[model samples]
Target: MNQELSESLDKSCKDLYKEETKYFDYIKKIKETAPNLKNYKTNKSKKIDQAFESILSYHEEAREVIQRKIRYANEGLKTTNLLIKKYVQQELISKLPGWEGSSNPPPLCGKIPANNNYIASNGDLVAASIPDENTGSAIILCHVKTYSKTTQEYKLVDFFEDLNKGPSYYTLPKEDVIPIPRTLSSKHLSQTEFSKNEKVLAVYPETTTFYPAIVLESPGSRTKKGFDTFYYSLRFVNDFVEQIEVYARFVIPNNEK
Candidate 1:
């Protein structure tokens, strides 16, 4: 039985190697094709740009898929090694009592179970600050997913509120406020998640002293697609300030299960 299992494991490893080699060859072909595609002249710059963008996007997605496959293969190799050492050898298996197998935590942030649905709905929150001379203001930007058939474009909401809740609440009328439309470039479209870039605005609004933070939420449709939500908080403070802190929480429907 042990010998059969070892042979099976060896075959799996060989199959994985072949798959890896195929993926590497595909990547090389993509790299070789990129320069030729770039040199092709077209009358319409917009059409050319769009075509190039699609190619890049396909390349990126394919790369991610290949990487995930490689990761799975490596994990399988580790599991096979532990199984052989324990069951086949028998020496190590007798010494350790109640040892099921060698356990490994998740790749990111330890063994915390991630909420994929939330990530799909609310894109991601990113914050940054702009400081010039004696004056500077913090910005909190939320990238809300509006990619469904019902919705047209992504929405970014900026808030000027205290990081720590106080009695005073900053309020601005919707009509009075004007939000600058942020253009999406090819680089921005490639990312599965959203991240805001810091910019120094000409006019700083008058508001109470407050740290900045952002909350990202995906659309309801995206949650149904099984993508975990991502949330991030950032605080910008002057060099003189002592403590800077932020916290975030999310609620999802059908969360009882």
Candidate 2:
């Protein structure tokens, strides 16, 4: 009886080892072929599309995970203020990015109603006209509002370190930099004056009282030649405000030369 039991145990051990080796080999093969996998090959445009898709996917997944955790924790719990505080601390607060404290909330800002218009201008040598006659341009209006314990200020920064770094004339990818029409000279508009233009439609505060409302627009869209416009927004959270909210819109033209 003892000999038979020992033989059975030895066979089981050998079988387990064989299974483990098979799985290990399988994993090794996958890793070796991963780089050459057909699915990984993509054109530049497809890569960009994939990147954007990935960003959206991650955003959605994170949101769902946060909500699910919050719901699970709050199940059957009392709706008291203390319970609310505990649930947020245990589930939601840390999951959020850039969330410093309950006092400081993340700002929400995005393009509002999309507007596409057609405007024609003679290629002029003025501060607000396109440089070339053949190429057409339009204005883009973007607005941002932030509410929090801190006041927010917006500004556009030069994406390129310096013109001398590369060719003076070059076309930048729309994703790499904000599009600003070259027809309009950056020097022409003071920060405040630029912020307030007739093209400026409406600006309103968001639901959060702490967030301030903002409206911004660029005079044109990006083209093969170059971006007719270049602009960016800088939000400064006031020392007093803990949370910031932002909303904006970009006015693009219907056609581009």
Candidate 3:
């Protein structure tokens, strides 16, 4: 179903492009014909009048075709968005802890949402306010999994350090945790701005999790929201010779004092 919707969207886009091309061609004809009839001195008056009529006809026809194509394109876009949203919600439900599938489970993958004042479901990554290091006045990334819904409590932290005992979940309230931002979902949890040679944590060739890394070059993007919307080259901290290009969204701050 998703594939069919995607193909429909592609065809709709192509049709819109064809309509736009036709509109441009009509405009080009008007421009070419108008310049040739300068003051009607060299050209016959009947010819000039006929040329004006042709230009007006082309303009009206282009407007009609373009408007019709735009309406069709909008309907296609709306259907595509609705289907995609449905699939995403279904996938999110499958990723929740203790979720069981009918025959096959939906694939679980996506960026964890950022902080917001609401109840986060199980499988969410969040930030727990802890004292400096142990929770006096510090913070760390955690994963949310409901151990007891009646008490409004959860087990946070689903990751582990390298060579550790693997990931585990600890207990905390939904109120104590802030859902981490998607920008920080796969990042090192540092400040937003990263300069050249600045220290950072980045996901590997992919975004499973963040590892210690350093920025290697200038950030690049179309707009002014640098780290929030840029790409940077980075080198991992533990490894010596494995540099990778990462989107700014995947680059994050290391939990430093």
Candidate 4:
């Protein structure tokens, strides 16, 4: 069990520290690039600034938040190590010979193996996005499980609300959609057609899929090269709650498509 505790501690802290590094990198990137865009004549530049403002506004605040999380995770690791040592030295040593005689069973005592190759009901950790009902797109942790005798499905909790309160559910195969709504016209709608709160189909990054989303902001228009373009901020339709920045060509009107 000490090994398991150690492994879990390492996994949790490793991820937290990784995230802390990412936050610092993000802050650094913002500092390095955001100010340089001040003189640019594009509305997209303003959008970039606005997009990072909330994060950049309180650099100290962001640092404090990330530092607090790192500190908490470190403290947790220390506590886990102390507890593991206390149990082994103070209690388990005397009871190991007569293991069945203890009134309370020791948790994690030879119950979970330290070998990482063993696949539990949940498979390896994977990066995934889920369809969100309330917020559009939601990022979630999932365990890949055999949905049937042959098919594999991800066992995940709903990303919204209290995830621990509900029964476990599996991701369906059909949810991995390439949303090609055939209702749309061949010519894309202009940026002027998109309005705030309008439901539209927009492209998800790095996927051929288009997701239903709501337009959060249409931050005016800008002319580039010989043509005009518009930038939009969108929140996805289902479990994906992450806000995305999209060009006008990517934001399809609900009436047309």
Q: Each candidate: what lDDT?
A: 0.33, 0.29, 0.53, 0.47
Number of clashing pairs per prediction, in order? 12, 44, 10, 14
lDDT of 3: 0.53
Tens-digit lDDT track of model 1 for 1-257: 23455457567666766676676666557655655686455576557567666766676676677667667756875665455323422331133222122333221111122333222233332222323255553333333323333333333333221111111222222222222222111111212222332211211112212233221322122234543222222223232433221211211111111
lDDT of 1 at 94: 32
What are the per-residue Cα lDDT tens digits for candidate 2 across 1-257? 12344346456655655665565565555545655766655566466556555655665565566556545434523233234334422332233222123222212111121123212122210111112344453111221111122322222111111111221222222221222222222222222122422232111121101112222332221212353333322122232533222222221121222
lDDT comparing candidate 1 with the true structure = 0.33
Off by over 4 Å in 1: 1-42, 89-257
Model 4: per-residue lDDT, tens digit, 1-257? 24455467668766766776688678769667766665665767767667677666566575577678767767876665455434422331233331232233332122111223222244332223566798786444343543332453435432211122233554655233111211211122332335668887665543323467888765342222323234467888774556776544345544435
CA displacement after TM-score superposition, residue 180 of candidate 4 (Å): 76
lDDT of 4 at 6: 49
- TM-scores vs. true structure, each candidate: 0.23, 0.16, 0.32, 0.26
Please report the TM-score between candidate 3 and the true structure. Answer: 0.32
- The lDDT leader among the candidates is 3
In model 3, which residue pairs have backbone atoms overlapping below 3 Å?
114-181, 130-135, 131-135, 131-136, 131-137, 132-137, 132-138, 143-157, 188-253, 190-253
Best by TM-score: 3
